[model samples]
Target: MAPTTLVLNAGSSSIKFALYRAGDDVSLALRYKGKLDHHAGDVHFRITDAAGRELTAPDAHGHADDPTSALLERLEPLLGDDDIVEVGHRVVHGGPDFVEPVQVDDAILRRLDALSPLAPLHQQIGLAAIRTIMRTRPALRQIACFDTAFHHDMPPVYRNFALPDLGADIRRYGFHGLSFAYIASRLDAHQRRTVVAHLGSGASVCALLDGRSINTSMSFTPLDGLMMATRSGAIDPALVLYLQRTREMCIEAVENLLYHRSGLLGVSGSSADMRTLIGERNAGARQAVAQFCARAAEHMASMMTALRGCDAIVFTGGIGENSPEIRASICDHLAWLGLRLDPVLNASGAGVITCDRSEIVARVIETNEELVIAREVRRLTQSRH
Candidate 1:
């Protein structure tokens, strides 16, 4: 039986997965890509093979007690004779310790849980899935690939905070490292100095020098970067202090406000979804969308400064790949930096959105974080042999 690996990205309300098989060229090739969205109620499971063939298309009424486990069980028959040899989980926060993917064990799991306070929104989900698999499929091998691992080697100038470190492991630990790594892999040699704007619900800008992460907008936690769909990014520290002291809000209340009640949802007073906000004609909606784009642009410009000069800027993630208006808005702000967008191309979602004469080339590339995790699992598994 051929060997396969399953890559899992368990989020708070969704579980994204991909199955990969070792290709003839010794590369891990995606077999099936899927997502299980259980945001409000039912677990809406969907999957498609590499050829765009739908394997399991559950109806909107589908619900499960444990969607992750249910999805894994359903995938068993799809594999036929192929054996799922290992699993790779996308753990968002590595904190101050982890700098690379590691084979999972009881100790590692507990250590990861300790970092929950650092990434309250995302860290626990992946760990929960890992624990489930451990209890149910104890014999199966598992590995953890961190989102912070890619930026772990950043220079002190970019990694350090301004204030003095008072015995706490507090400093920038950039998120979306896997996405940035995949993007960097796709760039050509000439696209050495580049700024990648990963604009999903949780957005951030990363500057890559020769395909290596130099500096990124997301700092300490995923919440510190670009204003996301619900996250208030890079707010004044004094404002948090004011909320705690004057507003009389507890720490938990402050966390909820910053992580869930802020950004587009807070500003627009309607929806956190960019697509929905863009469709609305109200002033609040316009302001929400405008603020998101403006902040993204400002961070991208800062990332360019970190690069000294940017040769190219690539947009990836949900909003970055789909919304041309947002991309155009960000590019417009960088006009002084020689990033000129071709209106027609930008609207059409072309690979190259910038004009031929533009000094900085702008592009839109879809990111595949699953593939990176699959490869990492394969690497670790191979090394163990």
Candidate 2:
């Protein structure tokens, strides 16, 4: 049996996982990929082969309340007789420490758990998966690939807030670093000054100068930056204060409002799924879509300011890669930067969407955060051997 590396990328509502065959030379090859989506109180699990062919029936796994346990149960059958080695997790927050991928131990897990407040929506989920694996497969090695690592080197000007030094850990520790890093790897060397918009359930804009993050929209937490599927994104600090002081809402209630009840769902008063909102004829849905696109464009422009100018704008993540209408709408707002999309290319939803004469090149690139995790796992494991 071939030695394999398992990568788990836990998000707010789902856990994406992939198995990669680890060769003796430290090369990685895709084996299988799947997602355990626990959205709207429903649990669904599915897996696909390297060629994108469905390897399991749609109704293979029944609904379950616990996503973590369900994930392991469903994944066991797929493992068959393969010899699994290490597990790599995409942890959302690494705080001021862990600028690179690190092996997870009890002490490290405790430190990571303390960062839950920083990334309330995502950190615990990833950490929970890590802890579960450690419990069930105690002998197996586990590694953590942080989402904030890519922005660890961001300039202080972009990383710090205007507030006094409350703590060293309090800074613009950007999320989606794994996604940004993958996008950077795909960009041409000439595309030094780039603004990447990772639009999805959790969205953020990043400025890449010389293929390195110089600035990003998310600050301190994933709840900052562009409005997401359910997140309120950047809001006035006074609004939060007012909600607490005058509205008499408790801290937990306010956190729930911003993290779970706001954004597209709050604005539309219907759904948070962009695909659903796009097809709806309701005025609320239309407004939600408009706001999402506008806010994304505004944030992208903000990232451009960090780069001084932008040579290219790359769109990745769920909405960015699949939603042509969204890509066009966002680019429409950026027309002032001489960015024009070829209607044909935009509709195709692949490759360069920008016109030949456009000053800023725009393209759609599918991000592989799982692959990034797997690569990190490979590097860590190889070094030990």
Candidate 3:
């Protein structure tokens, strides 16, 4: 039986997992990938092989009482004879301390749990998964790959706010580091000074200089950046104060408003999914789409300023890779930067979408955060031997 590594990316509603064949060497090959979703109080489990063929039945269900246990039970039969030697997790926040992947222990778990307040939507979910695995499979080794580790070395100018020294804890710690790191690895050597727009439900723009993050749109938390599907994104600090003072909204209520109730859903008054908003003709939907594109373009431009100039603009993430219309709309706003899209190539939805004469090249590259996690896990685990 070959050794395997399991990578888990836990979100607010689901835990996406991938199993990889971990050889004695550095290279890892994917075996299976799937999600454990919690919807309407029911747990659903699904799995697919590396070839994208469904391995589990459509109606496969998980235990509502213990979703993690259900996930293990379902995975057991599929494992055949392969043994899962180590598990890697996508933890959203590493704060100021962790700049690289690290093994998780009780002390490290406590430290991660303390960071939950900073990444309210993701930190807790990831920690819960880690704790569950530790309890159910106590002997199995686990490692944490942080989402903020990529931008941990970003210049202080981009990392600090205007406020007085509030200590090391309160600084601009960017999210989506795993995605950015993967995108960087895929870029051409000549594509230095690139601005990558990771547009999805949780979106952000990042500036890469020589394949390393120099600046990013998110600051301190995921809430500060381009407007996302359900997040308000970069709002004026005074507006938060105003809401609390005159509106008399409590801290929890205000948090709920910005993190869950705002952005596309709040503006459109219906759905948060970009695909849904794109097909609708309602005025609210139209406005929401327009606003999302505009705000995304604006943030991309901001990342360009940090790079002094942009050599290329790469789009990744769900909305960035799939939606040609949205990509065209965003490029239309960036025309001033000498970015001209090849309509035919843009429609193809992959590869270079920029015209031959365009000053700035634009391309669509699908990101693989799970693979990044698996690679890190392999590296850390191998180093011990």
lDDT over C-alpha atoms for residue 99 of model 1: 86
Off by over 4 Å in 2: 38-43, 57-63, 76-81
TM-score of each: 0.96, 0.95, 0.97
- lDDT per residue, candidate 2, 1-385, as tens digits? 8888988987667789999998888799898898888866678878899999987565434444467667766766777788778889999999999998999999999999999899888888899888887877888889999999999989989988999999988788998999999999999999999999999999999999999999999988899989998999999989999999999999999999999999999999999999999999999999999999999999999999999999999999999999999999999999998998999999998689988999999989999999989998899888887
User: Model 3: per-residue lDDT, tens digit, 1-385?
Assistant: 9999999988777778899998879899899998888776688877899999987565446466566667777777778899988999999999999999999999999999999889999998888888998998998899999999999989999988999998998899998999999999999999889999999999999999999999999989999989999999999999989999999999999999999999999999999999999999999999999999999999999999999999999999989999999999999999998999999999998699998999999999998999999999999988888
- Which ranges of candidate 3 are over 4 A from the true structure? 56-58
Runs of candidate 1 exceeding 4 Å displacement: 23-26, 39-41, 56-63
lDDT of 3: 0.92
Candidate 2, position 77, lDDT: 72
Better of 1 and 2 by lDDT: 2
Compared with the true structure, the alpha-carbon lDDT of candidate 1 equals 0.89
Write the residue-wise lDDT of candidate 1 on 1-385 in tens digits. 7788999998778888999887544488778888877755576778899998886554444445566677787677788888887889999999878887998899999999999988988998889899888988988889999999999888889988998875437888899999999999999899989999999989998999999999999888889978998999999999999999999999999999999999899999999999999999999999999999899988998888788898999999999999998999989989998888999999999999999889999999999999889988887777766
lDDT for 306 in candidate 1 is: 86
Q: By TM-score, highest first, what's the ranking?
A: 3, 1, 2
In order, candidate lDDTs are 0.89, 0.90, 0.92
Candidate 1 pairs with clashing backbones: 172-220
